[model samples]
Target chain A: MTEVTLSNVVKRYGKQQAVHGIDLDIQDGEFLVLVGPSGCGKSTTLRMIAGLEDISDGEISIGNRVVNDLPPRERNISMVFQNYALYPHMTVRENLGFTLQIAKQPEAQITRAVNEAAGILGLDELMDRKPAELSGGQRQRVAMGRAIVRQPDVFLFDEPLSNLDAKLRTQMRVEIKKLHQRVGNTIIYVTHDQVEAMTLADRIVLMRDGHIVQVGTPLELFNTPVNTFAATFIGSPPMNLADGVVSDAGTIVLRDSLTIPVPKSARAHVKPGQKVQLGFRADNLMPVGHAVEEKGELVDLELTVALTEPLGTETLLFADLAGLEVQAKMLNPRPVQPGEKLAFHLMLDKTHVFDAASGVALRG
Target chain B: MRRRIPEWFVLLLPAFIVIAAVVLIPLIFSLYSSFTPYKLTRPSTLWRWIGTANYEKILTDVKFWSAFGRTILFLTIALNVELLLGLLIALMVNKVTWGQRTLRTILMFPMMFSPILVGFQFKFIFNDNIGLVNNALQSLGVSNAALPWLVDGNLAMFSIIFAEVWMSTSVFAILILAGLFAIPQDPLEAAKVDGCTPWQTFRHITLPFLMPFIFIAMTIRSLDVARAYDIVQIMTGGGPAGRTELLWTLMSRTGYVDARMGLANAMGYVSILLSIAFTVYFFKKLSAARAELGMGG
Candidate 1:
């Protein structure tokens, strides 16, 4: 088991810095995902760890060995690229056995490694086929199979599912997770799709603008994000944030003469006249009967439903609250029209308070 | 009254007539002449059909056979050597980041010169006493005596082959360079990540992608090399006991200098078999390479 550690690692392309000396320690056998929007240095960071790109500064150690100067081949790492970079001329068997062949292994050993990888990936039927003859998903599996045959110390996936269709992407994501469990190797997967990160990662590294915004369990990142970027980036329909200020009465004052008591977790961190933003998820602000949980402190609001999106089991109701459009979930079926009135319970304890100027979560 | 001709056929008639007058008629005339004792000066003898006499003479002729063998050797050596040098040059030029466009344009300088000009230029360069090569070697003190670059039996063949290779290696370089440019970067990157050394990557990944282009260059150069008349004639004149006498030089000497057009036409038709053979082989290789890359038609 190899644990990858990056300490003050930096990547610079000429005058511009892509990854700014970010430090992270990935535990052995942990499925760590680096996720961000485009140009966020997540791929650059993973490439540096994989030795595909050079690190401009600091050290990255794999299994307690400093691999700063090692080539990708010497580093003992296998990587799956975004475009599924399978050798187009070679058949599936050749592609899988290439590394072993390059290493000058015996013909029998090469065949065994190739066969085992093919079996693991359900690729026995495809051994004679070339990459161009396969579909996108099949090619992706071949790419994964090639990586598997090497049996490297670590596995790096750079947006591996980005090229697949939505259905195929979901299917491959599960296969990747299953492969990780089967191999039990340290895998560092990079993706901009938060759902993939949430489903696949044991712990997710949310990055923004060359900085690590937060590193936490999927649930931890979903439940308690460190900042506004993390809160919006990690969850679907993103946590609804409303502009507000802490008033003299120790309540949060919002636009259009509305006020709510501060969330208990951020109460001590708020000062009178402090400018802040209130954050709550769609599940936290549902209508009375459809609330996921009513254990938290609740404040009722009569809001006009601006839109309704029926998602079979649950419908997301968008309402105008203090001129900000807030999404609230409806667990029960509803034939709701736009501008209809509904009573939504705002869960105060489940809400977050961020300092408006800095966008940092105000924790007690 | 005659039925009105189709408009498309009417429109295409001029092209067909031009092709027949300029190409087909001459081809037919030459084929007919090859069966007769048609000397250039004796135009009346073109009608006298001496069936297979010229073909029989050349089939038994030792000089004709030697020239055919020499042409094949020239093509084999020149094509392979050009391919190797072109691949080397293209790979080096592909590596340069700055001024790459300028370097590519400079790389095409050999192709820009006319074949006749290239011949004369090499002819002067291979002049025994005052040639650039002999002068350079003498200046470097590598040789104390003047080397005969175009006179000795082996040296004459080398001079003509060197001149021909210099004139045409650029064709291979340009085509192979285009192949290099069109190749996907992902496979190269994948090879590296798959633990391939640079040489292994080149052998397994880069070379396979270039095979189709190499075969196409080979096909085009085969026909051009079979017609290797101008450079050989200028540099050595297939000379000094016919040491460098290729099929083109021998055919031209028989057809023009000896005025034996029928004999020369027979040799021409026979040499075309060589071109057709080379072309078919390269095309088969090209298709196989393309199919291997999953680009099969």
Candidate 2:
């Protein structure tokens, strides 16, 4: 087991910087995922840690040793590429045993390690087959097998499941989680899919445009995002943001005829007549007929339904709320049509208020 | 009911007629002439079938056998040296990120010249009295005597081989460079992570992937080199005492200069065996390499 630390690590491609200075501490045996949209420096950060890309400045240490100048082989790391970079000429057995052979291990030891990895990945029948003979899932498994046989200090996955279909990706996700539990190595996975980050990351590092926007547990980021980008990016269907100005009576004036009382928890973060953004998730805003916990202060709004999406047990209602398009959930199974008017309640405790100019969360 | 010919056959009739007139007729005529005692000056001798006489004569001719052996030796050395130099040039050119396109275009300059021109260029360069090589050696005090480049046995052979290699090595380079470009970057990175040194990665991954392309280049070059005439004729003329005599030069002398058409056709048929042998061998190797890379036959 090893702990990986990135201390102000930076990556610059000539005049264009891909990864700005970012610091992170991954505990021993931790499954840290670096995630963001494309060009967000998430993959670049993982590549630097893998020694595939050079760190322009600062230090990256694994097991308390600085590896800034180390080559990928000397860094004692194994990476799984998105395309499942198995040696097309080698059989599954040879692919697994390649690292040991490179290290000049004994034949018996190499064979044993190969067999063990094969057993772990359920590749016993495919030992004699080349990578082209295997299915996408099987090839991905062999890629992991190749990495695990090295038994390196760290495992780096650069969008390894992005090539698989949806069903296989989910299956491989669980298998990777199980592999981490079994092997207990320090793993860093990078992906643009927020769902994968939420499901698989022990601690997620959210990045945006060469900067680390936030780092926290999945639920923490879901419950308390640092800014509007994090708030919308972390959740599916995203959080609905509406422009508003706090009125003299501690109410937010969203439009000419619509005004809402400022959430009590955000009162200290804003002043009267201050411009702010009102944020709420689909789960927190629901139709009046739907059953909610009712623990927080609730406010009602009359919105016209623009669309409805029936998703099995519950339905998603797309409605125009206070001159802003918002998604609200309907717990009760009912048909919703366009132009239909409905009253929905906003759960104030679950909502967020942000500064209009900077997009920073207004937390008291 | 009346039977009718197919429309496709009618459409292909013109091509078949042209091929028969230009290719099939000459091929059959040569094969028939190889069994006769025909001379260019005596047209009546073409109908006299002297079966197996020319073949038997060629089988026992020591001079012809020596020329055949020399042609084989020339092809082997030229092909091998070209392959090695070509691989090196391809690797070096593949590494250049800037001006790579310009460098590739420049690399094809030698290939653009005709083999006859290349032979003449080398012929002057290797000339004993006023040649650039001898002049440079004498000026640099490296050699006092003029080297007999085209007269001596080994020197004549070396001069011809040098010209052949210089003119054709770029074929291998271009094809192998295409192979290098087709290699995926993922496996190289994976090899790096799997603890393979640069050399190990190249040996295990890069070379294996390039085998098919290499063999293809080898096959084409072998066929081209087997018909080695224009360069050898211009540079050495198979000369002083037939020291650099190859099959094509010897055959041309026998066929055209001496006007013994039937004997030359026999020699031609024999030399065609060499080309076929090399082609078959290289094709077998190509298919084997492709199969090893999991590309099905």
Candidate 3:
């Protein structure tokens, strides 16, 4: 029942605006992640919901209660900050029990709640030690235990895993996902890493500047990005895009040399002689004989390999198509030297077309 | 071997001579004088070694003991009140978003005044006649009588303690303010999200973090307040019947006005013990506070 909703939420600092009016609806028990580059207002949005930052001109409600003027404690929400923010002077037991203690619960009740959280987070042996005595990962677990002891309706995480190393971050990501599954509480997490957003989010809210670019599940945003920004921002090496023009014969003119039939999904959205950009990920474009058969119409091209990155099982081949650099994947990786010619197949079904001038997706 | 001076002692000779001349000699001289029946007016009495006589007399004197007790009481009350007031001021100033620097500078104004000047300022303000406190009270119709602020035993003591606090509270404030600034904002924010009320946050997160700073201020001010002489002397000169007399005033009066250098030196030695005790006690508390903050003391 702890569904969080933000309608036209805006944040302004004096003369400048940090977050424009944005609408969001977070479902109960759903793990939603707000993600973007630095200064994209994703953190600001989360803080506003957590009641740490004030919303300049919008209504925010938790469980049907308009909490615009209510204090954080009254909102029944717990937050884990980027830095663990453990009480340095207190032991892990005290840190975990603090919220309940503050609520004036009986000492016995607080101890019970603390012990439960400790057991859940595997903090039993470390209970007597202060935050300074704990390692980064241990401190992070204490912070989560502190947040859980309150048993709040919703949990808010602001780049909580950003401080950990790459290996630790991956480990904590699994811990967080497992924690969410066990707790079944509505969680709103924020991070700048797209991999985190893709892996952990039931829904990802991609933000840029002060606006939300798009909101969808990981597969939806990956398979169908709204525009060039989404296409380029989601995948690791980024989706390869080439500038081209629409032809009168249901084909695309690329660099004035090669002509490929337009992707069927975008045929209705483009008119003859219109400017457009062709977008496809490395996964969709594969070298022949190394790739499985794609049911979608495949356009074959013999492109010169510029470079190849061998990633253990698969090799990423960088090839030139009409003087434009594009990435293609080779599943059954074999060493290919630079300037070596290789035949590649572009899966038209997965390929996306965009209005070049507007950078808007042409798919219906 | 005895005929030859060791190279290590030779290397240290210059430093030893300098320290002995500057610091050790004066300390030894004072200790010697405290044991002798020395009088400043008669240099001939300097050689008279009357061991334990001065200490025995001063220890038995009712006035000396009273002044010693008064100094301790003054230190206790003034230090505690100043600590509490300074913490309040620092917390309030930390909340100011803009013009905080300007406010902090202004907060230090009281500390800039010399203790003597502060004593005079408060003496006049608390005067029964032609003073600010009395005048304001009379005009406001709060009282019709001119209360003897510097004559009554309790009021005179209050006036001097008030003066000391006015001149020194800013030390506590500035230190605590620095503590406030140094405290990471993360814990405070965490406290807020953890359902702590403002008071609870301050009592738990803010105050515990400020403990080391508070103890540091106490350690410094304990030494400063123990030797409170200038302000007490200027305002009361150890009386209106010796009501506001303290250890410093009693010692200075015995040595200078009464010319009993030996007895005064004996009193000074005793008071030095008090200062040392306070310092050691505060240092212990400071280290304990640092330990609680998980900083290895």
Candidate 4:
């Protein structure tokens, strides 16, 4: 396996700049994920890596070779597209052996390679069947099998599981992860789903509007988000932000007359009377008890319970707080009717402080 | 719920009636006439059921059989050549990124010109003395001898085939180009990643996908070739000792020029079998191709 490096890579579509200069170094055999919202240039970056698109500026090197001018075939990279682009005409065996046949490998070698791949993917029985005969999951397996048979230097997946249903997507995601472990090849997966990125990636590259925002492990990005975007993007029930002003005592005052203690690390960058934003994840806010009330600010919020979604042992509470909607996942299966007002306590030390103008997180 | 008649049937009634009157009636009438001594000049002869007399004559006549065999040969050669030329043209056009639309329209220029016009153009070009081809050859001193382009049997057939291919090959090109456009790009990309060479991708993925369209064009052109007229009529008129006599030309001479409508109806019936055979074969191939592509009906 060889590491991939992009040095100041840029992509342009006519007059429009789709991807701004992006520099990244992907380690050998690393499962690197590029995650972002739609139109964020994530797929474009992956396509450029696969050599499907030409880089408008800078260089891309694969396996220590400058692959800027190389076509996809010469790049030694195999791609699994979102739509599992199996040949409609060829059977599974033919599809798997297509590359070998094209390379003019002997017939015995082609059959052996195809059979081996099929066995690994549990596709041996379906080898004689064409793509139309296979179900979605089987087709996905075939697509993966098609890639695995190549044994290329790198595998590029452009949202390969996006077309499958939720149950199938989860199953295939696990299968893909297992495949990666078995093959030990460098993989660059691009997707908009944060959960997929968090679960599958060795290093997550978060992007917004064609620019890389942060690159780190899942937990690192979750706990140490550089800005409000990363902080809000990573969590399940995203981190909530409230407009607040720093009081003279160095605590931030919320709209509903609630005050949260700001950490000491934020005190130097932010001062009293300055506008700030209070950020906290859903898990940090809890129902207050008499004993734990001595630790931080105990400000109560009267929230209208808008909806209650129960998932086995936990219940998700969606409520309106100070005119902003917020969700909290409580572990107990508490019956919360819509329109019911509940008083909840906000944890002070667990909260984050952001500069109101720039959205940069004030760190401790 | 009460089952109401489909509104589509109401919308379809007019077309159905028009088709019945314009197409079905004529087709059935002609089929019936094939068994009778139908004469265009004398309408009364249409009802005279001569019952196999005309068929027997056509079956036994050496001239009729020769023309029949010659027509099949002409159709086979002309269609294959046209299909090959059309495929090559389409492949080239598919490669053209710039001015593709303009090139497509220009390629259709030959097809837009009537077969009769193409026949005349080629006829004059192949004329022995003052034609462009002969003049070019004579001026270049390639050959002092004047070639009889329209006299020799092989040359006559070649010239006619050339005219036929020139006039109709675009039919294949345009249809196959539409097929090429409809093919999904994913498989091609997948093939590239699969390390398939350009030729392998074309042979395995591209050609098989295009087979249905090729067969469809072939089927349509087969019938068109069997009933070949216009160009052959204008160019040679099945002359030079009947060297280039196709079924249509021979049948035309019998029915219209010589006014032997009874025997011509028999010849027409026999030629219909050729069209039926070709249409059936290509249609079967089309179905197989569709099945292969998993687009079953």
lDDT of each: 0.92, 0.93, 0.92, 0.87
Q: Per-residue lDDT of B62-134 in model 1, one digit per residue for the tens?
A: 9999999999999998999999999999999999999999998988898889888889998889888889999
Going through the candidates in order, their DockQ values are 0.78, 0.81, 0.77, 0.68
Tens-digit lDDT string for candidate 2 (B1-297): 888999999999999999999999999999999999889999999999999899999999998999999999999999999999999999999999999999999999999998889999999999999899999999999999999999899999999999999999999999999999999999999999899888998998899999999999999999999999999999999996999999999999998999999999999999899999999999999999988888887
> Which parts of model 1 have CA positions greater than 4 angstroms off?
none
Which residue segments of model 3 deviate by more than 4 Å?
Answer: A292-295, B1-21
Query: lDDT tens string, model 4, B1-297?
Result: 999889999899999999999999987877777778777888898889877878887889988889989989999999999999999999999999999999999988987898888989999988887778778998899988888888788898998998899889999999999999999998888887777678877998899999999999999999999999888899899977999999999999998987777678778888889999999999999999999998884
Model 2 lDDT per residue over A97-201, tens place:
999999999999999999999999899999999898999999999999999999999999999999999999999999999999999999999999989999999
Off by over 4 Å in 2: B1-5
| Model 4 clashing residue pairs (backbone) | none
RMSD of each: 1.7, 1.7, 2.5, 3.9
lDDT of 3 by residue, B82-190 (tens): 9999998898899899999999999999988888888889889988888898999999999999988888889989988988888888899999999999999889989
Chain B TM-score, all predictions listed: 0.97, 0.97, 0.95, 0.89
Q: Tens-digit lDDT track for model 4 on A243-303? A: 8999988778877776667765677778898888888887765443312333665556667
Residues A1-364 of candidate 1: C-alpha lDDT, one tens digit per residue: 6889999999999999999989999999999999999999999999898887899999999999999999888889899999998898999999999989999999999999999999988999999999889999999999999999999889999999999999999999999999999999999999999999999999999999898999999999999999999889888889999999899898999999799999889988999999999999998888888866788589999899999999999999999999999998888757899989998899898899999999999986
CA displacement after TM-score superposition, residue B258 of candidate 1 (Å): 2.3
- Give the lDDT of residue A242 in candidate 3: 93
